[model samples]
Target chain A: MSAEAPPAEETIASPRPVRGSLPRRLVGRPELGAVVGAVAVFVFFSVVADAFLQWSSFSTVLYASSTIGIMAVPVALLMIGGEFDLSTGVLVTSSALISSMFSYQMTANVWVGVGVSLLATLAIGFFNGYLLVRTNLPSFIITLGTFLILQGCNLGFTKLISDTVSTKSISDMEGFPSARKVFASHLTIGDVEVQITVLWWFALIALATWILLRTRAGNWIFAVGGAKEAARAVGVPVERTKIGLYLGVALAAWISGQHLLFNYDVVQSGEGVGNELLYIIAAVIGGCLLTGGYGSAVGAAVGAFIFGMTNKGIVYAQWGADWFKFFLGAMLLLATLLNWWVRKRAEESK
Target chain B: MSTSRTSKASQTSPASRKALVALSDISKYYGNVKALDGVSLEVHAGEITCVLGDNGAGKSTLIKIVAGLHQHDGGTFAIEGEETRLGSPREALDRGIATVYQDLAVVPLMPVWRNFFLGSEIHKGRGPLRRLDVEEMRTTTHRELLRMGIDLRDVDQPIGTLSGGQRQCVAIARAVHFGAKVLILDEPTAALGVKQSGVVLKYVAAARDAGLGVVLITHNPHHAYLVGDRFVLLKRGAMAGSHAKDGIALEELTRQMAGGSELEQLSHELARTPAPDLSGGVAKG
Candidate 1:
């Protein structure tokens, strides 16, 4: 049965006043601050680094952005649901390590290892969400515990299986060619070659934006993050929504891990130790709040783009690698302040 | 039990017609504490049943039982002539009972339309393509609020920007639109100004006019008397008094709600004691 009343006569005069002007409405978007920062950074790099404007260099910058953007999109979704996943960085390494070791030990098709890794990685994500809900502990603590366990396993298991700190090359195994083509292939778009990860990155951005803004689960996500008790009282299934968000993060980590393995033919045990902070930083810069319930996937993508630009721009400008962290920290503080100011203006105008 | 004579008489007279919700001698306990005890009330279609009490008078405990947040420990709770205990808020909603909590009714950061359809979102399309019907929901929210005498500047504004009375009205309209046969409101006007309270009570009346049963929990006898068809007064987890509209006067209802004899004792003690010398006390401090 329909839950709402039938439409009334259209001749009835509208009781609501006219909506705000376009610019006023634009300022209310969660991504407005990140877009502004992206534009500013683009201009600054173009002016300082002469090579930054080249199409080839821009493609390199995009490749860098795609790797981080893939993870940041889901992390932003998790943050909007009012939780954290500190285990994501090491979890990526764990996924890759599992896939490589399984394939080499079994002498099976690489696709089987890929399939197994997906299940194991998702289980870890489920474990984190289940512990958080059942224990009533903070998500930070639950995921942090998983983070340390995964980090230890990545090193310990790699050493125990291979007698080294990295996985053996699987480039010559069955199904390796097709797997590499799917995860790490390159496409020539006009004159510049682009990584397949860039395509995956854009596809994820589209999917995430749709889920955040258009689906029933999306509405529940906003509710659970905004006022969890109210959401639960009204039958929003708060626990299920949270668990689903953690699973989204794990799914993305699987894709990123597969890309790392297929691209290099070998997996490093310690490769992704601090990348979780990078993903979190990108989401926050994109306008996701630490407190939850106020962010967008597009904003996180823009945040990743800004990160990619600054990282490569420093090299093009001949700056020392040590200055990269300093620049990123400054950008984060400035973008956050701008987001706060814009949000205030939007509220006051309302 | 002494004050339940009118209720008992009325309950027998209405035996031919069942109430939408009926609670008889309902009691709840927490460990050794009697949070609520031997309370009886009935809500019928197109009627307002006002439960009046002071702080620690077990008003909240009574609401929790009917709203399905907690089950009653003793006695019977019936819905539409069937005796059953509700297990959750979802079960209550499925049975056409909707409760609007005072402080936790709406998520402040969401838009008004989103808040209107928070739990029961409308969707169209198949499988993976299924998505929220945003346009329909927005129009419906605006139309429903307008029908309730609320003219908004924009439904897209964060609900936090709305006045407290407007938020309550929005929540009431949502419950009404979702086909709630019984509406349980917990202190809807407790944190509002006099004008805002009047506005909220008007919506409560509007909901009743639309053929819904309402259980209004409040401490303000004046506000209660303005719209209540039946009054149930609570004191220390027991029924102090219960009356039909024609059986009691507003002044008596106010007196009983203000703790009856206890208020008299308090006033007598206050008058006997002299007013404090504020200037001397301040100088000593």
Candidate 2:
């Protein structure tokens, strides 16, 4: 029922709105650091490596980025909502393993296996979220538990069902051709062949950005992340918002899983063991606060792009790939410091 | 008592404004300890009913019960004269009872517009494509703050930069904007400086003038004396006194706030003996 009491007579305060200048708006963006970092990295690489500017190499970078971007987008949103999913790394492998093993064991159509895997993967996500909410445990601890459990299940279940650590080839299975075309197919743009994952990655990023910027749900994510008690005092559904975020991570994992299985025609149960950190690193580099509350999906996509450049740029420059992790570590630290400076500027400039 | 607790649901005019919220003989127990005993309060539209008490005097417990954060063990809490139980803060909010806590009212890192609409954000469009109406919110936030007599440098600034009083005012303005019928402020001026406290008292008066039933809980009788129309004093989980503005004087209100007879006993214990000849001797030297 609506309030039966008398309504407020008039507005309380009547301050006029100050118009936002272009520069003020630019500085207010959480992604400004990531954008500047991306440009700087792009310029540095272009000058250092001759092949970095080529269309073919650029397409390769996009492809590599897409793989990580797909997961990073949802993970970024999750982080903004004040949580993480450590199991996401093995969860991706588990998704592909389930589809492949189920198909091979049952000798059924690959599509049927894919459907079953989808349901199973989503259940894992639901469990992680439910356990977290019910126990009031940190998402880090809760998801780490799920990660270890899923990691074990993936290996043990695959060995028992397939007699090997990897699933049998699904190339000749029914529905394999269509699934492959949908997920693993290549597109020729100019002289470069681009993976279908790139399209999926772009679509996911656009969807995530729309949710983060526009929806009431996006508002709830920020509220819940920024300060849950304050958000709760205002009647925001804090628990439900957090649970939904975990589910988003699961759905992204499913997409990435489908891509992995279709691309290789086989699934390794041990794959995707340590990719969760890469997703988190990309989101952080993209401007998501590790503490939660402030971030953007567009920033996360740029973060993945940086990862792609660094990964491919080194090989193109003929540098040893051994130093890749060292570079990744340094970039994460620098980006974090840069993001902190940008945030301070935004808060102080006003 | 019968005349004071009129049914609010049928209230019609400013002349005979009914009590919007009434808690009669409310008592709460924590296991064996009495947190609140036989406490009664009445909040009427266009008036501030100040609940004055010192630390551990059940001020927070009383606010928590009225704001739906806690359920009283024994009491009849009537809203618009209808007895009801509030299960959650959301339920209380739906019934037009908004409680602004001392410090936890707003997210400091969020911008003013975002903080203004933290839980109840305004959105447009349909389904997944729906987005925040940023321009609409910004304009509304600006207008609302001005209406509350709060002039901000910018709506885009982080809320943390605002002084404590401004933050409390923003919260008060938010409650008003959302159509709060009964505003319960938990020590709004407790942590503020003299000037800041004055700023908040002005808004409290402003809120009362807008015809809200305000329940202001505080320990400072001087602050309470400024805008409070009725005063309820609590000491050690029990009502020490309750008085209308006409019936009570400022000094007596201060005496009641200091636990009345308890302070008298302490003053007797700490009374100093006379030092008669010390000043004369010093003057002779």
Predicted candidate 1 versus true structure: per-residue lDDT over A1-350, tens digit per residue: 12222222332457544566899889999999999999999999899999999999999999999999999999999999999999999998898889999999999999999999999999988998889878989999998999999999999999999999999999999999999999999999997889999999999999999999999889999899999999998899999999999999999999999999999999999889889999998999999999998899999999999999999999888889789999899999999999999999988876
What's chain A's TM-score in each predicted model?
Answer: 0.95, 0.94
Q: Estimate, for each residue in A211-327, the C-alpha lDDT of model 2 and write its tens digit.
A: 877777888888788888999999888889988998899999999999999999888888998999999999999989888888889989999998998899888888999978987
The iRMS of the candidates, in order, is 7.8, 7.7
**DockQ leader:** 1
lDDT of each: 0.90, 0.87
* DockQ (0 to 1) for model 2: 0.38
Candidate 1 local lDDT, residue A43:
96
Task: List the candidate 2 regions with Cα displacement exceeding 4 Å.
Answer: A1-16, B1-15, B271-285
Model 2 has fnat of 0.53
- Relative to the unseen true structure, what is the Cα RMSD of model 2? 5.4
Query: Lowest summed lDDT over 10 consecutive residues: which window, candidate 2 chain A?
Result: A1-10
Clashing pairs in 1: none
